[model samples]
Target: MPGPVMPDQAIGTSMRNKDRISAFLTLLPSIILIGIFVYGFIGNTFWISLSDWGGAAALAENPVKSYVGFANYLDLFTGFLGGGFRQDLVNAVFYSVMLLAGAIGIGLILAMLLDNKPRGESFFRTVFLYPMSLSFIVTGTIWRWMLAPQGGVNILPTYVGLPPLRFPWLSSTDAILLFNWQNLLPIALYLVSLVLIIWGLWRLKNNPAKALVLLIPGVVVGGSVWLWGDLLPQALFMEEIHGFNTATFGIIMATIWQYSGYTMALYLAGFTGISQDLRDAAMLDGASTAKYYRYIALPMVKPITISAIIILSHISLKMFDLIFAMTGPDNGQTGHPALNMYLTTFRANDFARGAAIAIILFIIAATFIIPYMISSYRQRRSR
Candidate 1:
């Protein structure tokens, strides 16, 4: 600390400081642009969601906007006229679950098969991935015809002397797993308890103390819900039933067919990066091919799986083009929140409600993305 700085050292420090200043100046424009455009638009959208901005006045040059707090959001959730939105929300949940399961499962299987290096591996890989090259609109149009009630899939049985299936693929009225919106509080609590209990059970062997902490609260909440759930106030004065509609089956099938190949490519890349020597060592240790993949390869590619889930979850949330091409926007049987938002804003001239719907979707997307980002940051810092 007492030594005087040498000429070369002092020059080096000065150069470093100058370089830092140059870098910051270069990045300043982009930072300002993003702040004004992206975050600014988001903030403006949120403000619109909290105001009254709809009807014929919405398109006016200086539309009168009055703050309405969370009225728009409340109306979407519990208002009598929100029945369609409620059903669409339920459909979105089912769509997300089925898409994640089907795409990830089929992709994993396809990747595993290709990893064996069969003859014509390149050709098979290309064939499997070809569907992903087409746009959603194209895929939806193709599947729409193939799923027609009397023409395509339904007529396959006729080739073997069986009568054509009479089941309607896109216009079915059947529904299952019905639940009342009136009992929303209890159902939500039950779901929370289930998630906690499942998570605790999964971690029980690894960290008993932490697991017990999660388990005990989960049990208490579940027991309270079971014992006194009826005391909770109903979300709606009238019964509003929602469930998985049978009509969405065809749309889901087409989505899986289109996206499974994309996920398969993701998994294949992850599998390819693994060291061959490591795989050989596992085989030498008496691990079967299935065990090698299930226990070794999968764990190594956890990042890839997480990435796929995040991407698919976002895609499922904003699915519009495919649903539109398969069943038009007016088709109540295959309605989605994105389509509903469009109709409410443009067709019905309800700008505030549309903004509310957009905010809700944004929040839901953040829920999936924020946790992943935080975890990734923590992991990098730890490393």
Candidate 2:
């Protein structure tokens, strides 16, 4: 027993449908362009990575591409010729860790100092942030000169009546914390277990039961790995060692100098957004300035810290131009995946392997970004 629809209701419904159709039409072109360009290219690259499209005929007009499944990936990780790539991967990990620690730590300190409204704050902020305005190439070049073996930094010691140090900043052959590639499987398992245990400990206060679920499995796996690690199959047939090269210290220092300012700005803005009444309340409760920031202000700006970590992680992964300008591609001590990819593709004409490296980098980048995206989406939906 439905009532007859009103003429006004019908008109409004028709108008709403029309509006929906108009919006869809307006967005259709962008959707099409992105599909054919960004996603399409990514799909094509992935296909190339799985194909045998390399060698001398790779660049030919009618070049052949045959499916080879995951062979390229397998070869990169375990092949005899992939030692350089493995070392480069290790270098990238070290670079990411150092950059995250140095930039976030220094930036937070600077932000806290400025939050006190010190004299000449504006000038100091400008001075600290000036390096960020320069391109990576410029920063790399400047740092290269500063870190020279017998010049810039080395000469500073002579002015104070000390002998000029002759340490090779970019050409050093020394490496530390060496680990055999043959132990890769056990090492990887240990890392996973460590992560789980740390994560569980971090969440123990809020959700003890769930934390126990994580901790139990983590401890069991770690103990098992420690006891039976030798039983695990070796990642390679022969031993190959990799470690952190001392040569990359200069590059790391330069990167920290450039990006710390950017992070400082992010943290400063987050600090500025905190309500003054909250500060007064904290003071009334007898909270010292250090305790107020540590216990209250930092927790409020957790999102800012996450954002900085994500941004810096991405930059660290794609550290091509800076590394090239500072140490060049030939400097194996300071190599990165992006530079290695470029050299493999254009210089060595290995298209398939290059695509494989690209896809690996893309996957690594996604690991940092996808989690943040999912968290942000959840936050938005909850709101």
Note the Cα lDDT for every prediction shown: 0.94, 0.95
| TM-scores vs. true structure, each candidate | 0.96, 0.96
Native-referenced Cα lDDT, model 1 = 0.94
Worst 10 residues of 2 by lDDT: 148-157
TM-score of 2: 0.96
Candidate 1 lDDT over residue span 105-173, tens digit each: 999999999999999999989998999999989999999999998799999999999999998999998
lDDT of 2 at 16: 100
Count the clashes in each prediction. Answer: 0, 0
Error of 1 at 48 (Å): 0.7
Candidate 2 local lDDT, 1-383, one digit each (tens): 99999999999999999999999999999999999999999999999999988889988999998999999899999998999889999999999999999999999999999998999999999998888999999999999999988798878889889999888999999999899999999999999899999999999999999999999999998999999999999989999999999999999999999999999999999999999899999999999999999999999999999999999999999789999999988999999999999999999888989999999999999999999999999999999
